[model samples]
Target: MYHLPSSPTIRVLDRFSTLPDEYADDDQLVSFWPLLSAILLRPVSTTKDVVDALEEIAHVLRQSTGPAGDYGTLSKVLNALTFIDFPPGPHPGMTLRLSRSQAACLVAHQFLTSLASPRDRSEYYDFGIWYDSEQPHPRAAEMYITAMCVFFADLPDINILEEYATRDLEMGGGVSYVLASAPARSVGNTPMSPFRVLHNDVHVTGPHSPSSMDPNGALVVAANKVIGFGKSATGEEVTLGTTPEACPAVLVTPVLTGDQVVVITGASPVLRVTGERRNVAWEIPDTRTASADFDAWRMHRAGGPLLLMDALELDEHVSELGQVPDLVPENIEREVHKATTSFMATAATTVYTPLWGCGAFCGDPAVKMCLLWLAASMASVELVLLLDARGQALADELEPFVRRWQEKTAAELRQWLGRVPRTLRGGQVLAYIDT
Candidate 1:
């Protein structure tokens, strides 16, 4: 089971399993492979056991070279491993328990931080994932592999990520949106301000995307079979890249770290197309912390919701080669409903989406565009659609997409729902009525 095809940890271990130095030699770093593999076993294992294993790794890190290194780097990640109160959110109960599985992951990440730096973003590597087989979307395996090596092997510098965002905006990435025109806040261009939206309105907007790895609300990103954030190969996957932003920001920015890992893991897969996207619902403890630097200076991670919608299938191991869970109207409806509820609950002004299921996952853009509009129409939040930097393709797909729902009266909308083709709708959505 350690190498279970469906397990994120197994995928992680497999990547390193072949690396002689990482696992074979003494003091090579992966001295705890057996325990680490054991921690990721499914049929869900005990949390305390994983915690114990992590503590042992911590002991090694503390005694190895130095415990608290420069930037208190080791210390920062170590602190992130401790069990602190989960920030307040729509999922309050989920927040309370940082689950054993998550703890194992946090500790593994600390091991990485001790080896790397924030700006280095070790992903600054010389090579890519050379697949033993055709690695269609190597990101899934890469993400899990990287997760196991967070502070050690390779990490993408966060500042570089910000720079990427600015360049994307400037070049307009073959496509453009509403947010590009809006000025990047003076202090936090990388991590923009998150705001609350109480007013009921649908605004066609863009320029910013939750996928950009910076926004602080419920983020929507695709996941690989292992559920790691490395789903996007070119680093263009907005949701996946942005998923780590909130937690790491909180980890380094003292005001936000409540002595807990900034990550949140849902009890089950948030969206299981073929395999789980792992436990990546993030809740940084930045509920009340704000600065003159931040736009929604007062609104933190708790205030903003990061919604991770599992909308892709990169697991060649799953089923028929390209058969992915179709983002039918139902799945889209379900995701939108949850996102709307979270934003509404928190008064999050917008949901900066990057064509939720339209990327490598391959959801029909016209359909996704239509459904996205409907969902935002239903929720009435200012739905910000960020045609990503490389989203010329997506923009083209959505070119003919018309927000026709805005003109439809509630009664008429309901009637259209009934006549919609079977290909366009599903029962889960059929059962949902605004009233």
Candidate 2:
């Protein structure tokens, strides 16, 4: 419930109140309030052109009822909007919990109030790309908004409107956010979490895949969910990474807890709403309209949560050095340790991730895999790596490689990371470490 005209002193919309003819219909009021509130907030700032455009849209909404769509659904959406408010402020270990309906409302709120978010934000910041993009995509913004309407609508055996009303009663029915803190650095030999591998997409969901991870309460790793910690836009839901699997998962994330993905030292917890495979599969190129198959696109809480973590950027460093990047550069080993340690702090016993920081970040997958395995070992959580085609070779070599170093303490591993040859890349680096 972030009211527009943030300050009471700025009565920019007072002139509209004096005009009697504008406030005639209640339906108009229902639809008009969101637009009006946005205008008063002046999210993009008080530029004349932007103000004029918003006023024009508001004027159109005020005069016309628009469509014969379900006002009942709209009412539920509005009610959810009222209940949905971001935490008062972000501090260490702050927690905000929302039911499935409230989570949908949070997504809706992000879309409706996207104007207030920064314009220069990366595409990961909001759903504008899905709706506002000229090319014929799934229209994710409209789909999410419509999905909220359907979810909140009065239906048999389902009371979504009442879901948020009794949030305490629901057991794992909604999303929960915990700004996780970095874990204490370990020096002794910590028992390693069980390790496994899956050669598939990180976003893939089915019985054949690891979808059963929901019941175990797992936390899947999203590659680079948000960047730019301070001085970045606090609002808008952005994608995490540019990868085909990771980018579209933003639809499930709905909204970010604070400005950056890594607001805390290590991990930013996000709820990856399960059962909405079609909506999140944006790269598949949907030919149907946004409103198509509304009944099938419900958000199920079965998939559990996703841990949004950003790997250390090593592309520039690797390019400049003209040799293969090792795990020790820029305290990259410490960065990986912080993320895995943060994951260990959460309820999830397992963490599924790909070769993070390997793509545009230019991190060597072999080096990254070794570092992640070492960190996960220290955290005592099961690590299931979702490897692509290129990573299968590393996956084969990783087991024996890790087994050889399994007896080493955390301090010994760090010492070993520093001693590895800088000239070696990929499996060669792992071979050097093994030696």
Candidate 3:
């Protein structure tokens, strides 16, 4: 039977203290670290023992999260899990927004089941990178062990603490999600919001993989899979094309269709406790320092709403584009334009975005920024672009255009983008405007 989750009950415990004997009466409350310590410390004699260890991990997760109420088992706490119950895919002109309690419940459900899938664990589990690496990443074992200790202790109350911390944001209409479409060609005088750059990762609160230096780590992709817990599974992957671009938990929302842009406001700037870059913070893992990385994410477990849009995975198409390493074709710019306008046109608030599609996706920063700027002008919503140090330089190169074109209407900018020389470099494409 299915059940809906409610607000998590907060129970405080001494951070450095050992498991107390008196608390044994509460089946719902499990001391996360001690149980894990016991499970890992035991010996594994055979392949069967290894399998049993995985089961033990799942059992521990179920115990820690506990059941929803008198009738709920922790594993069954969510209203739905498989795609059969929670349908996925983009629903144009629809919006699927969830309350804080509902979002937490969905995350909790993913915590219970996502790790159990062997395919998921094999491919996406952050810790697995360290485990399977032939020449393991530097200090891989230490990073894993430290994360195991600190991350779990923070889980039970993560949602409640986040709610308490972000109460002010929640009161101010909380996070809003809207899927918007491209702007019409007949643009008017929609004054663009001033653009600013910051040397930081996107403000969405989540942990990255320190060992391998990957930004979209457990916190971002799999909802804190770094904690090293899982439920047993029937060995099937989540059906493709029926899920969100990020974690399956995003499927929590009910209405998903609308315009082309998926704009989210009030996205929590997850508190940054370590060096801003993943490579800087996670490159040389130390037990003393690694725990802080997990703590940073732990403090903001109840994150704000996220806009789910997938960049074109351009790395795979390098063969088609030939020698121009960073060139963005005209079709690609349209996709970026669609992504920006949907959110900009409808939302009544400013949008915060990272350098979209510039990382592993291989997008050109200048092209992306131009497309976003044009789309926002059409929609008339303010746009704030988040950037790392490298992006700061690119922003500097483009600021001149931003100032010069401040008076240009959306229709004018759209026409300029259409005529952009595809052969010109991404940054150089904007330089053509002066000629």
Candidate 4:
């Protein structure tokens, strides 16, 4: 058997007058809060006593008829509390018979979850609790209203209220201020996936890669003609063989007017083309072939020629070369002409690299790692083109990548969460009140 504290009805009236005007129309005052608050504030001397108090509040609220004005407030409060289903439990205390205005206050208070300090209370009121001052989302307003109710209901002292108002206005405005500044977009609506560039031709080789080429390994060449150009105007060719040097290099016969054959080898060292010199490295006064000289090479042809050399080096060469090979007379003339024409036509064009897609919810470490891997992979592709240009095909490729990553990540998360212990299992509700 349960028991309710004496003067339960008077307690309700006292608390009702203290509710904020923001919840004037809320209805849950009679329907839920009195029972909930009693349950929350009641002592746990005997479980049966608490149950009796809860049953009394529920019985009184259900049978008692409220005036029209009070009923409207109760309706609003009830509507909001209905969002959260209350588990069956015993309650004890002076069960408050909340009026319509008080119900509204309870509804508003339940929504605010972030308010930490007393100062936040005044800031919340200044924002007009229900007014849509922050993000356009309805949840934001609902949260403010709920938090205020919880704060007032839990601590009903006037001194506490004054302290909260003063602190909120002075002490960094608390969590309500943060909520007011947050964007209204739903958690799931945030942009997580990035543009991902997909290309089968390009592959990156470095210390991070599982298969790093030996420093002294023989150079591997792929024979591929420039069939198309990337968004950066860099050439794209289907790799033809393991040894492109072995095959006859196709002479790019330039048909454009004012095009001159320029033989650009490693590091863009403009080889001096004389009738006497064939595949000879000429020492130009200003041009020097060093690690730092790669930047000068990238500036030409949207870095197409430089990208090709990098691709070749990643796949084939492991060690630094002493000198760049000068092609035969016909090959040199043809390459130089192609380079000159391509540069003139598309020098101003820009290249775009695509970022990879991410899972819906990723922890900090996982997100960082995922981004790092994505960046490395995009660099490996060497295709400075907008993946969207490929449209549906590019999107299709991303699906598998995202799926594999999500599965791997989810498994790890589940394993971690599994270690947490569950306390409640039986029908008896072991409610603990922090006093």
Candidate 5:
């Protein structure tokens, strides 16, 4: 049985083609819009109805398939939408279906992902912010994508839609980093679990490997321009003039060298933010992280199932303290949007991060705190702003910030969601499989 509710509200829009002309043209979307509108108009909806509509959408896409790349993009869109809420019972019209921003985001997210070859990604770099010309604003793009994600990302409580993201992210593959991680069961156990944050979802923490500390969950870290990788110790320079071979899917994203949002899918690490390739690309062979900055995003890494986010821009010159490079409010907003967005995604159950900019990067922890606090504030995930090597000194430095984060930590806000293993009610299994 489904749990209780907050408040039931419903609204219906009669039109489907309400989106403006600026959105990228997609023949399939053009035809499917009306059907989508009808689905939303239902006086009442069932979980089955939601899946049927998705099937219809996929059916149409299959008919208009362009190439292998097109299929891949379509697949990701489908996958991301795999976990959607139908609001069990008679509630209807609770969707972002008609928003032009959502449509534009759809097009932007899908555009080049299906291309057979790499092309200039500058055109789609920035979405949401309408430009006089086609040139993009990375910051705008990050914000737009994050905003649109709320429409169908993860949600509180259990629903078929919400579970799909969890299923694909942890059990199989979807738009997440688990697929890019090492085998689920490396020590000869059953298959390893997929990367996801199933419970106690919130945000906070210090710099470290994105997936190492709590392999069961997800982490976010900085990257460096230098080609080498480091261990658990993040925010350092580890350039070794080496590069991982690019996977075919890297072409879908418009990544450039030293740009942020390069995701690793259990193998080689490739840039996923800009279209150009770096002379030397960074890779964390053992799942370590490095230094970089951001426009905030989660992009698919080539070769593996993990999607990397090249959010940080690398400060080329190492500083006396460290390369902290220039900081921008937009940069903070972009990354915060990501943390918030990922928090919404089922993949981020327990959000952890470090004192970002305070390392060799030389950024003021105070400035970083404002942005981080904004992210933690907006997120539903459990955030733990860790007191690592800095210890009491750093804690003393940001006493107010620490207190603020603590105040936010309550049972309703954050708690320990211990997983209780399951067993057969009948007792021990003394039988054998016939498979």
Candidate 6:
């Protein structure tokens, strides 16, 4: 019911008109017109002439290519026809008719023949024809399939078509295109800064405790330096410390070593460092010790100070990170949910309702066509969900309807879903969802 532009026919005619007489012979012209017309619009009758003409046009269109070649000329003619004024209605030999505006637009496209080219010969075939071919153009076939389900009133056959379109779109780099544009932050491209550690010593006038720095002896401490900083993938830098003017650092005193581990402790403002590093390492005592007690413990007292840096680097990176772009899966899920809910609601209301009171309803083909689109869109969502176990929840609710429809269509739905026909002894219904 939706009016397609007559440009296809007009362009073909325009191309014919522009051709040299030899190429535009009456036999070829007349033969080409009907064929092109049939290709552009669905044939109204099963007559041999209409069918033969369409077959010939399709053959030629499929093989035509190159500059000013048969394909190029045909494309030009079709483009011109897009702008012609043509009436819409049930035509004598066409399944659908074009409106005046649509026709005129087709005709106008003829003038823009520069847009036509034989190089892309695959664009001519529609879904019905393309699917019937053993070797169809990947892109053209996909578009044709989607167009049939989406633009034509072919709700019953949309499931397979929709899947084919989705798969092709995914393969044609659509998902990667979206992901490549996503934004995120990384820590490999940031600045590093220094930090510090401090130690304190104490002297006790008590008895000589083994002549070494013990809890009752003198204690000596030293200061060590370290730095802390953060970075981002974009090369941005952030420094960590008490003051922006100074590097971040920690101080400790009275380093103790035992059990192959070092321990440092303090009082009031207790500071402990633990761990081992080849060049520089610091350890914190397992037990709390007052600054006074720590000051008294020493034996050739050693002060080890290690820096606390990059601890918050990962955290900073995560905080600065951006969201990823939406991909096909997410997009499809959203559309499917929206469409499915609407269709289910409508089907629930209409399938069992009586038609006696539905009077004076406009039987406009356009309205019917729109309804068909809604049905197909809904069905497409259902079919996709059927391929995954996750859809079981939805499928359970629709099982009754699905079974009924399957029975009515002679299992056409199941066949399209890649299951064997019902007549097959080993035919099995595949689980709709991934386990």
Q: What is the number of backbone collisions in each predicted candidate, taken in the order shown?
A: 25, 7, 17, 35, 55, 57
TM-score of 5: 0.30
For candidate 6, lDDT tens digit of each residue in 1-435? Answer: 211333233223333233345544454442344434434454343223333333344345433321222332223223333222222321212112122112112222221121222222322212122323232233332222222222122111223323333432333211110000111111121211111111222111101112222232111111111122111100001111101111101111111111011111111111121111111111222332212221132111122111111111111222222311111223222322322232233112111100100112211211111122233333331211111232243334334433444323312331233332222111122233110
Give the best candidate by TM-score: 2
Which of the predicted structures, 1 or 4, would earn the higher TM-score when compared with the native? 1
- Per-candidate alpha-carbon RMSD to the true structure: 18.3, 11.2, 14.4, 32.7, 22.0, 37.9
The 10-residue segment with the lowest total lDDT in model 3: 233-242
Better of 2 and 4 by lDDT: 2
Model 1 poorest 10 in a row by lDDT: 174-183
Pairs with backbone N, CA or C atoms under 3 Å apart (clashes), candidate 2? 124-238, 124-239, 125-237, 125-238, 126-237, 224-240, 225-240
**Where in model 1 is the C-alpha error above 4 Å?**
1-109, 112-219, 224-226, 231-305, 312-345, 388-404, 409-418, 422-435
Off by over 4 Å in 2: 1-97, 113-115, 118-125, 133-159, 168-173, 201-210, 225-299, 318-320, 406-409
Residue lDDT tens for model 3, 1-435: 121211123222322233465543355354454444444455644433433443454444443222212112211212122211222221111112343333333333333221332322333322222222232233323232223323322333433434543453454433344444554344455665565554564232222223221222111111121212222110011100001112333232222332243433332221122332233122212322212342344323323334444555557656554433334444445544545544444323444466665665666777767666665665555556655555667877777878887766665765676666656666677787645
What is the RMSD of candidate 4?
Answer: 32.7
Question: What tens-digit string does per-residue lDDT give for candidate 2 at 215-316?
Answer: 434444433444321111111121221111222233333333222232111111122222222334322112212222222222222234555565656665
Q: Model 6 misses residue 287 by how many Å?
A: 93
Off by over 4 Å in 4: 1-44, 64-162, 174-435
TM-score of each: 0.36, 0.60, 0.50, 0.17, 0.30, 0.19
TM-score of 4: 0.17
Query: How many clashes show up in model 2?
Result: 7
Model 5 error, position 120 (Å): 6.4
Report the error of model 3 at residue 10, Å.
30
Question: What's the lDDT for residue 257 in model 2?
Answer: 25
Candidate 4: worst-modelled 10 consecutive residues by lDDT: 426-435
